[model samples]
Target chain A: MPTGAEWAIIALSLKVAAAAILLTLPLAFALAWLLARKRFAGRMLLDTVVHLPLVLPPVVTGWLLLLFFGQSGAGGRALQALFGTTLMFRWTGAALAAGIMALPLMVRAIRLSLEAIDRRLESAARTLGATAWRAFATITLPLALPGIGAAMVLGFARSLGEFGATITFVSNVPGETRTLPLAIYTALQVPGAEDSVTRLAIASVVLSLAALLVSEWLVRKGGRHVL
Target chain B: MSFDLAIEVPRGDRTVSVTIAPASGITALFGPSGVGKTTVLDVVAGLVRPSSGHVRVAGETLFDAAAGIALPPERRGCGYVFQDGRLFPHMSVQGNLTYGWKLAPPAQRFMTLAEAADFLGITALLDRTPRTLSGGEAQRVAIGRALLSGPRALLMDEPLSSLDENRRDGILQVIERIRDDLALPILYVSHDRAEVDRLAAQVVELA
Candidate 1:
């Protein structure tokens, strides 16, 4: 047996991934709505910026994270001074990095669903006496649920597998910030640690596959039923 | 105060302008497609702003360009039905019917969910979602949703336009029943002369 360390890392990874999805959801909905509903000049540019991390090298994204959230950086310093909390070398920081890395995929999924919604339905809601915001809450939000669910699951799965940004920003500290990927990397390094690595690798694969299944089920159950 | 409306909207090269002062009953906006029949309905519903206009519904000046008063669609209390039935996809039939009930004024809520469902013959389908409904069923649900809002006036933009000939006649019967049973004024839009002739009490031509 590889002991409790491996088990702890797997559980912590799930927790961190879930946290990242929870934290990113509101922003993702706002972004998805803006992208799907608004006709603005810089919409394409904003979309490209959100998706940049997807195409860029993971290590490069990690390096960028380190540069942005490091102790001396502007946002990092401001946070440290205001809340006496440090993001660098912490699990929270790893979650933030994971969240940013997973954002584009989630946004794309949710935005596509939102785009498919019929504007006429919304107009019907308006004429039924719902204000624009109220209409969105009652009609738009419910209608967009399937896509939002898919986005959340996809984001959570992406966060679990995130390595480059997690390693660079949080530095893979044992017990504090060492996620599943980091633990797997460490296991492969030590002498005769193949068994532990194999177990953790299997755990990662199962979790990701489960998440994907949930996403598909959500789409099937919740996708648009009306025009 | 019942319905004092005047609107002129531009669509491509042509302009559609009509003024109708309705005391009561259905006021049908009849014309060919691209003639802006639906455009007039849009203006009345506050879905489309006219190039220059004054719209007064039930004594409230909804849109008066001269006075700089342009009420939002929701505030205008216009129940609009599009060519295609736009029932809320995520909601059960009951939920869709009750959507407007919450928004109507407490005193103005004359139509209850059960009453509307009964009127539209959707009692059995209340638990089903819109996706399960046929075209005629969906339009009936849309009408019920709109009626539950307790709108002072109804704006229907080709409500039967998308249905097959068989389905259209059935839904037209429901519309006639609603007009007879309900007290509110209805502004029905349609390019089809037969539908207009069958359902409308008075016709207002838009060019």
Candidate 2:
């Protein structure tokens, strides 16, 4: 059983993960669709860039984010000018880092599903008077539902586990940027915080396991029709 | 209710050139496998771009390469029933049947949902998913879906090849009714001589 403060930390972690998923979902789906369907110049380059975060060290990814989104950095300064807000050392910054870390998984899951779709069905839709957008909305999107669901769950799980990028991008701050992993790290430095660490670790394992089970179920469901 | 197509399409290392002009009835494009018979239908349906060609259907110029006019598949109003019957697996038979009908303009719609279902003998299968349907049942639903879309023409590619003899005869009767009663221009593709003879008003061979 976690104390009230610990519970707050858990809640913050969930909020960050949820926000990260929301932020990344649409962009991930769009990139996935483009990568799966189109043939164009620099497609391979685009694919490599998308997968860079997965292969690169979490700290490296975090450094890149910080470089681009730091208070004085171009994106950070532009965002400040446009929105009159800053993400430095904030929960929103944690979400940005988590989302970037989770993006590759989301895009990969969605791209696989999109590629698996029978393009002939889209052709059928077109011949039946559906426009390109309508065909994708009706036929392609529905068929890719299970994969999209799996992508969301996988992304959420990855976001929940995200530590290096979040810490590097937004230094841990209690009740603000202090999510589960950061809280656990904070507890680890104390000599008598073993019990707290155990509790948090258990919660993290349970959340990750649940997400994996749900993703697996979605993949199985999608497999029946997605050939 | 006619088609005049003169097109050349690239296929791998080779190119397939074909010219077809059929007026007001079923015209069968008969050929063995790998002869690019289906490619011709694809060209007419605007699924494939021709290197140099013109496609005129029902007095509308669908594609004119020289003039730089190419109508997309949706705008062409071609009701194409593919070889495998590509029914949307997510939707029920009723949903698939009405997908095109819902897209068509109200004034252009000559057939209602119930009428199409009744015409194709698929009224009973409307609530079922496509996965539950037999081959013949799926084909009928496909045909029904195409007809309900208010198309000026139809392109069927080996629509009956997958069915058994009994099921084929059943669909054959339905097709005959479509030819004699509905009077829509049809571009039917099949390699079977007997099937072509039974259905086509004119046969064009691809060699």
Candidate 3:
């Protein structure tokens, strides 16, 4: 592969991961809030399901995604029948896979921070003539902001590195579904491709490090006020 | 405003049943620690729903078990000033003070944001967040936040307990000023006899 092709893979990976993070954040925040704030039946089951992608083998997770979201499956059929959309072997599929993989970590980070908040602050807001939703929007949501930022950063980074599920759910196809990890793997498999592997490896490290540094900086900037 | 409340609240292994109809002016709930003074205020503020009882404020029904009318805290129109002054960390002093005031219904709003800030002597700290505030400053801001909400009544639970002597005296003076300045009733919860003696017009002692 030429240098431009390698850069294309990196660009495609970033776009996929960014899309995945966008898809994941709102749902992760809601799930985290449900787990952290409200008490309800089946909470444990919901929590377990959200974390399944973490404990299960990445390949298994990918297979499960394929089973549900594939063209023949109920989820896939429903989407296709209703919206004429397809996820199988597409970039959208890659995002779905990565999003599922990163959700647990995202939820956990947000939940931890939300649980640390003083409920009394919300109560105080309520006494100040604020409705429950208003209190949440003004008091609880803003207080949980730092954590939300951290969760987004974590989710983005996890998506960037996502591989197993992506390859399983949406097979590697250059410029279509092949992300940096898939590209790197392909480079490593060929004979006399050591030079390509070394370059991609260096690129991967630099990209991941840059992302991590950005997140750390963002979290720290927001963390000062919360702390 | 005045109230008629008869409630039985389960407190761990014990039950705290207190019935007292507070008269006008500051009705101080005076009691030692753990005797349910705060609990009574909580019930009156609509923060605690009694298993069975009625809470009538003035001519309105805030909570009536028999009638199945239990207004949530926000609808009760009662401003609560907590002991620790639970100011929203994200908002500046001005935002905290006007948070509820701004949210209040147009007809229900009595105090303007500027008036509240001026009343609490927090006009200077309008742009400052709670993180930089002193304990007394935070409580003042909390009080301003509560009062500006245009509540039908005020429920202050040991609002000066956490303060030092100087700060306590300062807050006590502010409390006295609020009593004279505002028309709303105050349900002041305090364990200190000095506070009760200095401020309360009618003392309801709990055991």
List TM-scores of chain B, every candidate. Answer: 0.93, 0.98, 0.95
Q: Point to the candidate with the largest TM-score.
A: 2
What residue pairs clash in candidate 3, if any at all? none
User: Ranking under TM-score, best-scoring first?
Assistant: 2, 3, 1
Local distance difference test, per candidate? 0.85, 0.93, 0.86
Candidate 2 residue lDDT tens string, A11-102: 99999999999999999999999999999999999999999989999999999989999988999999999998888899999999999999
What are the per-residue Cα lDDT tens digits for candidate 1 across B1-207? 367888778878878788988667778988878778877878888888998889998788999988899899999888887777778877888888888888898898887888888888889999998888988888888888888988888888788877888988778878787777776788888888888888777888866
For model 1, the local distance difference test gives 0.85
Per-residue lDDT of candidate 3, residues A1-227 (tens digit): 33988888888888998999899999999999999988999999999999998999999999988999888889999999999999988899999999999999999989987987888888888888778898888888887887888888788889988999999999998888989889889988899988888888777788788878877886787677666
Ranking by lDDT: 2, 3, 1
Q: Is candidate 1 or candidate 2 better by lDDT?
A: 2
Question: What TM-score should be assigned to candidate 1?
Answer: 0.94
Give the CAPRI class of candidate 2: high
Instruction: Tell me the tens digit of each residue's lDDT in model 2 across B97-174.
Output: 999999999998999998999898889999999999999999999999999999999999999999998899999999
| Model 2 chain A lowest lDDT segment of ten | A218-227
Candidate 1 lDDT for residue A214:
99
Could you give the CAPRI-style class of model 1? high
List the candidates' TM-scores in order. 0.94, 0.96, 0.95
Winner by DockQ: 2
Query: What lDDT score goes with residue A80 in model 1?
Result: 86
